[model samples]
Target chain A: MADLIALDDARDERLRDYTDLRDVQLRTTVEQERGIYIAEGEKVIHRAVAAGHTPKSLLLAPRWLDNLSDVLEATDAPAYVLTEKAIEQVTGFHVHRGALAAMQRPQEREPREVLAAARRVLVAEDLVDHTNIGAIMRNAAALGFDAVLLSPRCADPLYRRSIKVAMGAVFSLPWARLDDWYGAPALLRELGFTTYAMTLADDAVSLEDVEPAERAAVIVGSEGPGLTEHWQREADHRVIIPMAAGIDSLNVAASTAIACWHFSRR
Target chain B: MADLIALDDARDERLRDYTDLRDVQLRTTVEQERGIYIAEGEKVIHRAVAAGHTPKSLLLAPRWLDNLSDVLEATDAPAYVLTEKAIEQVTGFHVHRGALAAMQRPQEREPREVLAAARRVLVAEDLVDHTNIGAIMRNAAALGFDAVLLSPRCADPLYRRSIKVAMGAVFSLPWARLDDWYGAPALLRELGFTTYAMTLADDAVSLEDVEPAERAAVIVGSEGPGLTEHWQREADHRVIIPMAAGIDSLNVAASTAIACWHFSRR
Candidate 1:
């Protein structure tokens, strides 16, 4: 049975997992050190559990405790019940969703292991925005992309903002950080994948013209400064979305979705 | 010639156009009542001017004064130069972009007029996020969509964040609101548009299977609720972006981009 503990004091040390929710820097560091991530709202918390992530603890408002009884019954983790005011005091923000779960990070998978049976993949390079990362994951999962390989500098998809924006799609998508950001292109090539760098260059083939290989990987760049020339040159093919004159490009996340749509057309 | 004025006081009443920018409700009311919208940063401000918007006034940091001299020389609007700190104090946020312009909101065009000659259009229904609206605009512009038609409850594309996120694509792309959000389908039909509501209905045709019309409009819905039943039923065709077994739909912005890319191929 799960331990249902009453949380009367917001300052309790046990509530540290939910404190300073708005402090990105503090939360990121603490989460990384503790090897855990925050899953906010009832739906997202449910998704995290479905993804097989073990919950260290769950912070729930009184009203939410019964609503998530099934979820609580499935886990042995302690559930901390707090008043709305106490949750606000602990999280440093209003608990609008009425529930939050701090989940233990699942073990990392090697890129090769993730790509072993995959056909369509998205490789994100140096993307700094968590929302964009989450959106890409959502699009990738929706459009049948098998896995996401992120450059070392990409934002954490497990972050609360990303999980919220993705509507829990991050939990369903398979993703891993690339150990060698610089060698990403060569590594994909060696793994029997044809890499297409999504870019805007004169010589790039239109998205409609490029053929997806049996095993294909589309490499997406950061929000700004696009893909560095090195990675662009490394890919076997460069494809452009063929925009109208004058307008430069689609938002990175939008581009990811369109690219996935094109690649999955087969 | 634009008049150059020095502004040291952040609390000056004349600087009201640029105050407390983080307060969306307050800013929306003020901008709407003043019959103007803000264009932030050098790039978006330049885009607004290039789109032939009339600038009511320009608030520029001293460092940005020279950078935008060509723009200033082109208008008779007063340019108020403030220190970075004063700009921050006035805007309640760091003016990292360093400039803001209060530009007259362009006169609203009728939906019929915007769609009259357009071969490709994106009809946004009840989209509430400014960033999504902006991204849709950018995608529409980049992918050669001719215009955008928004439902009544859709967010204002002229909002600063939308302008910023769209990278000022809203200035270039033609858009108008459908005063009758519920009657949008009938109006589009009367205007000779073959409407497609992007949905995930089991019987919906795959995007690849649906042929484009001579004049096509793809209708996307809100982030929360997809297209309402009434709008979906009213659409000429309901199309699905075929996905993997268990996955659902893409983000509305992502759906917009993919849909536009599909329509533009014709």
Candidate 2:
């Protein structure tokens, strides 16, 4: 069982990891150096604990401690009971969720390893928005996508905002960074996967028309300039979600959900 | 042709609408009162123009004026061309998109009118988050949802951020508010529509099992507290997207997409 520590000072040294979060640069640097991120809200904290990402410490109001007794009992981390006002002061915002946990970043699997045994994988290329990345992971996890592979330009999935937005699915989903863009396609093909690059090109096959195979991968791109021409040309198939003619395209994350659902159904 | 006016002063009274945007309450008031919103970026501006939302005025760097010449030809709204520094000063931030348009909110149709002729519609109840609302609309539009109907508690579809996040689909798709929630489900049925409320109850039929009818309305709720019991009881069918065990539910917007796509296919 976790030790329950009472804290009244907002500036306690033990709470340094959760301080000054509104400063993006400082937060990013702290995340990079310490390799940890904060998960907000009781649901997300519970999810993180359930996924085996053991928290370093849990912070909550006295009222919440009883509610989270089960979660706290399952772990050896210290549960810091703080006044709601103190927590708000420390976190630099009103903590609406009543509970939060700071957890160390876990090591990510290699892209090849994440894809090796996968039947359906989502490959995100240059998806820079953290919220979109988080949303995609949540959708992928819910819809039964086996893994997510991120290109070099994609935002960090374990970022604080992404973690919050993903509802802690980022901790559970198998995600890997692929730096070698040129060789990644070959690796997927070697894994016996048919890579389906999502694009809006005229010649691409509609998502409804694409036949489902045993192992398939869906590649999504950044919001504005979608999948690169090289990727579209090199993939095993270019799949298009049939859309209204005048409409530009669905948002990247929404498109990812649609593609994942299609592939999962198949 | 639009008149090109040069403005070097940040304190100009004409630039009042573009100032202090980081203040949420002030901006919300502006959105509520004026029924007008700002569209950022050249692409979104172009989309607004394509959808027939006339630009009240265009604020851009002098260099972008030449690039926007063709788009400006159709509008008589004054185009304010300012230096990058002046534009930044006026908007209180660096306008990286190099252009912004003040668009008049188009008149909304009655919910009955939108539903009366539509084969498929999306109904949102108390979905307060603008981004989620926008994402839902974008998904609905992309996946063949003919119209969107919002209950009284739902977010404003015409809010500036919603319009931008939706990629301007709020202009393209038919949408309206239901001031009286008690009468909504009955009105929907009266319009020859079968209401399918999305829920996670064990007894609810899977979306796959709910055979699509001629006209169907897929109702979704906010993230935390789902659809009201009143609305749930009124639904002709309560359907759920079969999710993996341990996962509570997909995001409301994503679930709506999956449900919409299933119905669209039928």
Candidate 3:
């Protein structure tokens, strides 16, 4: 049961979690420091609740209250009701979906725990775009990758934009950040997974030519510079997706999708 | 040689092509009605020029002039020089790319002509998002697809955001809008292409199970609602990428990338 608080002012101090969301730098810092992330829209809010996340609070227009009544009933968090215009003023964007929840960010998971039961996993090294991270998470989950590991520099998968782009795939997919990025490849190898570093090096074998392994992990890199040389050198093997001449490469998300689909167990 | 004219005012009538670019409705209507499209940044501008698109005019900062000097020598279009702040004011958004060009939109190519020499092609139906269309173009080109065909309602491939996201792949890729979308599937078949309609229908066959053909075309629908019933019924085969249970589907761009990579001639 939630306490339905009607808010008339967008600048209310209690609404701090939902303010300045369009400022990525401010939100990233405030969110990490406070251990909270935002779930936008009805569907994503439902997913967050189903994933066992606790809600710190919710901000919603009157129209969304009924649709989210069950979610409110499941937690004791306060639900703030605001007019659509006031909600927009608070969030700094149109609340098109008409609902949002401030969820408690779960403590970071151990990389080994995420990979313990996994047979196929994805390792993202320094991917900095929230949309790209979200898209990759959706692809990995839909394509049947068991889990994911991210280098410390990777963008937050739980960012509002990332969650929206992923359509809540980030909630269901198990992922962990690697504190020691330099040793990530060796750790996966020791856990009985063969590692494939995706790259464009001339000597790299084509993704189509690589045989499926019983337990495999694919490592992808950042947008511009791609996989750092140290990470590429440390992986067990380098794999390249064969592309048409002259065109350099596919966008990171698209390329990762192809690799995930190919490596997924039939 | 381009005529470089210095301008201090953001309200110059000559800058109509570059005004309020952040307003999608206004720009779409204006650009199409005028038979022109914008090319942003130095790289995209260069690719647009290389693809034989004549620039009507260019809006640039002094810093970008030196880098674009060669392109200037190639075009007789007048170039308007402004400060970075003025460029931002005129465009209603920060011009981080520092250059913009209003280019003459190329005449639409006939589907038959674009597909005549093609063994592989991609057909996008009603994809209204510029980013998705751009990404799909990049994937299709990198995977060696011969050309692309768009439904009449599809977003313009030459839209600035699409061109930027595609990393100028749109300039190199041959694409055209179908004047008659209802007859599109049949047209592909008539041109001797085995059409594969991407869908989530239970009766659809796995993409991996399908054999490579002499000539193939993959049809992808819009972001939501997927393929129209008409297109699905008319396609030669309904194909689906095997996905994990409980997940609906991959992003249109990602699924299309996997399809293009799989159906590409090895």
Candidate 4:
């Protein structure tokens, strides 16, 4: 059981981790330097606990502590109980969810190792938006994609906003960054995987037409300049989702979800 | 040709529609009262103009006016050319996109009309997030979904934020609100459409097992508290996208895209 500590002062030193959250640079720098990230809301905190992430401490309103007694019992971290007003004052915003947890960032496994045992994987290239990156991971986790591989330009999945947007699935999903897009396809092929690059080209094969294989990698690119020509040329197959007359393409995240679901079905 | 009206004064009464935009209440009131919306970026502006939306006016930096000669040639509305500094002062933010357009809201078609000629339609119930609403429209347009039907609780599709996030596809896609959910499904059935409701129940049929039909309606609910029990019971088919071991469901927009593509393929 976790120790419950009562905090009356909004400026307590122990609450430094939850302060000045609106400043992106300061928050990200703190995360990188201290190797910790904050997870907000009761649902996400519960997911983090279920995924076996160790919580350094939990900040919650007294009302939430009383309401979420069962959840508090499952974790061994100290709980800092404060008034709703005090909690809001420290966080620089109204966190209506009432409960938050600061947890250590767990080390991730290499992409090759994750792919070695995977049947279906999602490869994201230069997806710079953190929310999109998080949504892709959430969709991948929900649709049975075994893992996600990110190119060098992808946003940090552990960023505060990404974790919040992902609903904590980022903590459970297997992800790693690949430094070299030029050589990554060769490594995937060596691992018995067929690569499919998603594109909007007229000549590209329909996603439904691709035959199921034992292992496959679905490659998605950034929003504007989709998959680069170099990567598309090297892909084992280029697949397109047939669109309506006036529409050109779906958002990258939406397209990725459709492609992932199709791959999962196969 | 659009009359190039160079305005040096930030307080020009003619620019009232584009002033103090950072005020949320004022913007929302204008949206509700005037029923007008703003579209940003050169590409979206071009698409909106091409879609026959009458431009009320165009606000552009002096540097961008030179590049917009072709666009100006097609419209007779006054184009207010301002310096970058003046543009920022008027809009209450840095105007990096260099161009913006104000458009009068076009009249909407009835939901029944949009569905009558459609082979496939998406019914969104109580999805209030503007971004999700926009993304869903973008996906529906791209995946060949014929039209969209929104329940009364859904957000306004013509809202400014939704228009921007949708990349102007909202103007091209056909959509309307359905005041009656119960009667609507029955109407759809009478029209020879198979209604499929997405749910997370264990007994629901896998999406892969849903046979293709000539006419189909895929119903989706808000992020949490998925399809209402009434919708689930009323639907002709309950389809589940097979997920991984521990995950629950995909994001609403992501799931909608997958379902739309599946229906289009069939």
Candidate 5:
């Protein structure tokens, strides 16, 4: 059984991971420095454990103890109980989700490990929004894409918000960041992926016209700026989802989902 | 040209239309009571005016005046100029998009009018999230769906956030709320629509199996709770997107987009 400890103060040293939860800048830095990410709510906590994430500890109100006893028992991590108010003070937000788990950040996988044996893959470039990244992961998993490859600047799939927004898809989909951002298309090409850049270039062919291949990489970019000029020019094919006139684009994540679905169907 | 009026006080009565912009509940009540809705930023404002909506007035920073001179010149409604800080104080937000507009809410169209000749239609039920509602509208417009029909409880498509998220697709897509929620299925049926309720019912057919009809209504529900049981049973057909095993569902808007894309193809 895991240790069940009582915590009284919000500033307790043992609860260092739970402080200032809403300060994005501070939380991002501290989470990185400590190599930890949080899983919010009961469902996400369940997903975290099921994904083989090692929970460093858990913080919840005493009332939630029985409901989550099994989660606590699955790991040797301690469960720290506090009054709801104290938990709120520590987190700087209401603990409406019942519980939170601080888990060890999984080591980054090599791009090859993620892409090996994949038939269809999503290549994301510098997607800055955590929600968009998470939604894209969920779409990738739902559509049965084999792998995900991210440019070095892409949002962290395991960021707390990303994981939550993805409904824990970050845990299920195999993803890795490219160490060589400049040579991503070349790397995918060498790995036998027919790289298709999703863009609005004038000469781009309709998404329906692109032939899905034995190994395919559907490359997408940030919402506003879109794929950098260098990457767009590097792709094997330029593809556009034929849209109704007068609209420039769909939300990045939505477009990615549609493209993935089309490629999977083909 | 719009009456060029400069206003310095955040508390001025003339700016009431733009006050407390971030308070959803208050804005919802006041907007409904006054028969008005706010359009945020230059693009949305332009779309609103272009949709034949009459502007009551506009609030913008002095710096944005020249950028929107043509838009202001197109309407006789007064334009109020305030310092960015004053605008922020009035709206409780930075007004970072350069302006906000108070426009007369277009009268709800008859469901028949929206469905008149639309071969593809989207029906939204109690979608409480404005962003989801807006995205659904964008998808409908982009996928070439003829119109949208909303449940009585749906978030307003013209809500500031919804307008912003839809990128003004709300103005282009004709939509109406069902006055008779309990009998909406019957109403659609009476109008010769082959109504398909998108649900997770165990016996539901795969979305691909449903035959696209000359007149179709693909109905979706709220983000979290989804369609009520009664409505689910009332539809002529129950359909589901074929998701990979172990996933619950996609975001409502994403699913709607895919479904629209499918129906349009057929």
Candidate 6:
């Protein structure tokens, strides 16, 4: 069982991880440096623990202690009990679910390990928005994509907002960032996966027209400019979701969902 | 051409329509009562004007004036020029695009008028999030669904955030809100549309298995509860996008995108 520590001050040094949760820029850097990721609410905390992540500490409202007792029992981490008002002051937002955990960040997995047994995969390139990363993770997992591979600059899937939006899919979906994004297409091909680059190029084949392969990797790009020319040229196939005339493209998350659905194995 | 009027005060009574934009509850009530909607940024403002929504007034920084001169030349509405800091004070947030317009809300169109020529349509039921509504509009428009029909309680697609997220697709897509929520399914059927309710029921047919109808209307529900039992039973078919086991469902916008793509006429 966890040690229950009652705290009255929001400025306590132990509550550092829970501070300024709304400041994405600052949280991203600080969390990374601290080697921790925040798991918000009961469900996400449970998922994180279930996924083999160790909790460094937990912050909970007095009312939520019993509700998350099972989770607390699973970890020896110190559980700080405080008023909901104090939580809001510390976190810069109301703790809607009244439970939070600062989990020890898991070691990064190699691409080879993540894709080794996967039959279908999603390769994300430079997706900057954490929400998009979370949504994409949910879409890919729900649609039966076995794993995900991210380009070097992709947003952290474990970001609190991403984890919340993904509803714990980020915990279950196996993903790894590529150290060398330029060679991703070739690497996937070497791993016996046929790669499909999603783009809006005029000559690209319609997504519906592409035949499903035994091992397939669908590459999606950043929100603004889309797939880099390097990935677009090197991927085995360039696919487009045929859109109505004059519409530029579907939102990245939306298009990823459609692509994942179109190539779903189930 | 619009008369360029300089304003130093954020609390000017003439800027009533542009106040408290970050406060959703207050803005929604106030804007609806005043029969006006805010179009944020350069692109959305232009789209609103092009969609025949008369601009009551425009708030812009001096830097944005030249960029929007063509639009100013097209309307007789007074343009209020102010510093970016003053705009922040008025709107309660930084106006990144440095331009905003208060456009007269177009009178609600009848369902029949919106669906008369649309072979494929989307029916949204109580989707409370403006961003989701906007995304759904962009998806439907991009995927070739010609019109949208909203439940009485659905969020306004012309809300500033929605318009920005949708990239002004709301201005191009024909949409109407149903007066009688209970009679919506029957009304669509009466208008020659075969309604398909998207649900996660065990007995629901897979979306891919359902053949496309000549006149199809896909109905999606609110974020949490999904399609109500009433709509699910009354619609011609209950269709589901088959998902991996243990996963609940995709984000509404993502699911809507997949559904729109599957049922696309083009």
DockQ of 3: 0.84
The sequence of per-residue lDDT tens digits that candidate 4 reaches over residues B1-266 is 99989999988988877877777558867856775677777887878878888888899998877667878988888999988888888989887787988877777788778888899898999998888889889888888888899988887777767877777778888898887766878988988889999988889998889996789999999978999998999999999888888776788989889888888888
lDDT of candidate 6 over B1-266, digit per residue (tens): 99999999999999889988989999889988999999888988887888888999999999999889999999999999999999999999999999999998999899989999999999999999999999999999999899999998999887888888888899889999998999988888898889899998879999888887899999999868999989989999999988998888888999999999889833
Assign candidate 6 its CAPRI class. Answer: high
Assess every candidate by TM-score. 0.95, 0.85, 0.98, 0.89, 0.94, 0.98
lDDT scores of the candidates, listed in order? 0.89, 0.84, 0.91, 0.85, 0.87, 0.91
lDDT of 1 by residue, B38-83 (tens): 9889988888898989999999998998878889999999999899
- Over the full model, what C-alpha lDDT does candidate 3 score relative to the true structure? 0.91
The Cα error of candidate 5 at residue A223, in Å, is 2.4
Model 5 chain A worst lDDT run, 10 consecutive residues: A240-249
For candidate 3, what is the recovered fraction of reference interface contacts? 0.94
State the iRMSD of every prediction, in order shown. Answer: 1.1, 1.4, 1.2, 1.2, 1.3, 1.3
Candidate 3, residues B232-258, lDDT tens digits: the string is 899989998988988878989999999
What is the C-alpha lDDT profile of model 3 across A1-266, one tens digit per residue? 99999999999999999998899999989999999999999999999999889999999999999999899888889999999999999999888898989999988899999999999999999888999899999999999998999999899999999998888889899999999988887798899999999998879998888887899999999767989999778888899998888897898999999999889944
Give the poorly placed runs of model 2, Cα more than 4 Å off.
A1-16, A57-95, A98-100, A111-117, A179-181, B1-16, B54-95, B98-101
Q: In candidate 5, what are the lDDT values of residues B72-96, reduced to their tens digit?
A: 8888999999999999999998878
lDDT of 2 by residue, A113-215 (tens): 7877789999899988888989899889888888999998888898878887777788777889998977878989888998999998878998878887899
B1-266 per-residue lDDT for model 2 (tens digits): 99888888888888776777556668778866777788888888887888788788888887787778877898898888888888888877788888988877777778878886899999999999888889899889988889999988887776667877787888889999988888989999989999999988779998767788899999998878898999889999998777655555688878877887788877
Q: For residues A38-117, what per-residue lDDT tens digits would candidate 5 score against the true structure?
A: 99988898888888889999998888888788888777889899998999999998979769889998888899998888
Assess candidate 6 and give its lDDT. 0.91
Local error of candidate 3 at A58, Å? 0.9
Candidate 1 lDDT over A27-102, as tens digits, reads: 8889999999999999888888888899999999989988789889998999999999999999998979989998
Query: What TM-score does prediction 4 earn?
Result: 0.89
RMSD values for the candidates in order, in angstroms, are 1.9, 3.7, 1.1, 3.0, 2.1, 1.1
